[model samples]
Target: MSTKRRIATLIASTALLVGGTVTMGAGTAAADPNFTFKYSGTTSNGSFTVAVYNNGTYAGLAEWNADPVSGHPGDAMRAGDVLSDGWYVKAILLSPYRLATTQGHPATYLTPWKTGDLPEGQKVEMRVAISNGTTTYLSQYYTGHA
Candidate 1:
């Protein structure tokens, strides 16, 4: 193709790509009773982050009017079980695993999730799991994107 033609083609391709990402984001996972998540996808990119909040109520973060859950036992957030209790995000989709653990209890933290090559709107399904050494609490499976 000629130089001018090539440039025009490139511009058209770019527009389509940007538009596609927005369209793909339309299917962003619905809010789960567990926690809240958000993702805006882009071509040729991967990984995303989600902030987990503990709404002090039975409904968890899903409840808008709930109070902030307090008491970060041990005063720190942890992935696996430790001396005390904390909170973490568990990917319950394909291979279940723990993502980055952020602040817990009285505070909210963001978790960085890897969704390798999230070019075509990758979907992330996970739940906020919390434990207090005695009982483990969970939010609904929050669906988000990357």
Candidate 2:
């Protein structure tokens, strides 16, 4: 086939693939709450970090708010402050053998809780990694029980 015809065929094929994906609901994957738990907080422009805690102990940082509801957690932002936000997360319930003692303690995720949706018997803390350009801010952990 001619060069022009070849180009046209490739473009048409690409469009068809994309359109099929949309028709299958590829864009609505985030709307499902069954995939993760939700948290709430705020931050400034730049990259923010989230760490998990359990019973006043640090578990790790690999699984805290990794997948955000709208975007991946710690996604880049414009240069400025931001409003408090909510985060959807999934709990690491633990593997076989060891009992799941990490329940109800926010699962030691990086993202903070919402303005008024934290669970009881849990203590959440956040440290703003201050920088010359980027800044971080989070709401106080709204413990369910004082």
Worst lDDT run of 10 residues, candidate 2, spans: 92-101
What does candidate 2's lDDT look like per residue over 1-146, in tens digits?
96434533553465466552111111112322211112333222212333332232333331222123465432111111121122222222111101112223332233332223223322333221111112111111211111
In candidate 2, how many Å is residue 134 off?
39
Say which candidate scores most in lDDT: 1
After superposing candidate 1, which stretches have Cα over 4 Å from the reference? 1-98, 102-115
Clashes (backbone N, CA, C under 3 Å), per candidate, total 2, 7
Model 2, runs deviating above 4 Å? 1-41, 62-146
- Tens-place lDDT per residue, model 1, 24-125, is 112122322233333222123222222333332221121110111353221112222221224333323322233434335333433333323332344444
Residue 91 lDDT in candidate 1: 28
Error of 2 at 104 (Å): 23
